[model samples]
Target: MKVFICERKMEVNYNIAEVYINKILFSHFWFHLLSLGLRMILSCLSSFRTLVNKSNPIASRNQSC
Candidate 1:
């Protein structure tokens, strides 16, 4: 009976550790994905802004004012 109780305690501890590790891994994955998305958006926006300025020099000059 004592051995059975000890085994149960170990099983609970193992389960808790598994859940904690999974949570950490998932958060890291999501943070990486979000940063990549933000970088893509910023790059695209900058390129678009440059294109607009190239097509309209007067507008770009006005914006500098």
Candidate 2:
């Protein structure tokens, strides 16, 4: 009957929506993780640069008697 067909169509639409939402969530999770990793790497690089600069200036300074 028409009612049974309509019910089937709604079920199919619900399943399709669920799949789409899941894919969006999965991609969001990866994007978040990637950004966090990049932030950590950038912080590490900046700290190393500071350490190198500090050491370089101290090593080159002339000692006063």
Candidate 3:
């Protein structure tokens, strides 16, 4: 009877460990995805800024003129 109880406890511990590992993995994946999305947004904004600056002559011309 004692051995059976020990076995059950071990199984429960294993299951809990598995759940914890999965949660950690999922959180890491989500963080990486969020970082990648932020980088893409920043890159697009930078490109848009460059495009706007290039098209605006006043940006390049001397302000005194």
Model 3, span 7-34: residue lDDT tens: 9999999999999999999999999999
Worst 10 contiguous positions by lDDT, candidate 1: 53-62
RMSD (CA, angstroms), candidate 3: 2.9
Error of 3 at 43 (Å): 0.8
**Candidate 1 residue pairs in backbone clash:** none
lDDT of each: 0.96, 0.94, 0.94
The model with the greater lDDT, 1 or 2, is 1
23 Cα displacement, candidate 2 (Å):
0.6
Q: Highest TM-score: which candidate?
A: 2
Give TM-scores for every candidate, taking all chains together and pairing residue i with residue i. 0.68, 0.83, 0.73
Per-residue lDDT for 15 in model 3? 100
Q: Per-residue alpha-carbon lDDT of model 2 for 5-49, expressed as tens digits?
A: 999999999999999999999999999999999999999999999
Off by over 4 Å in 2: 62-65
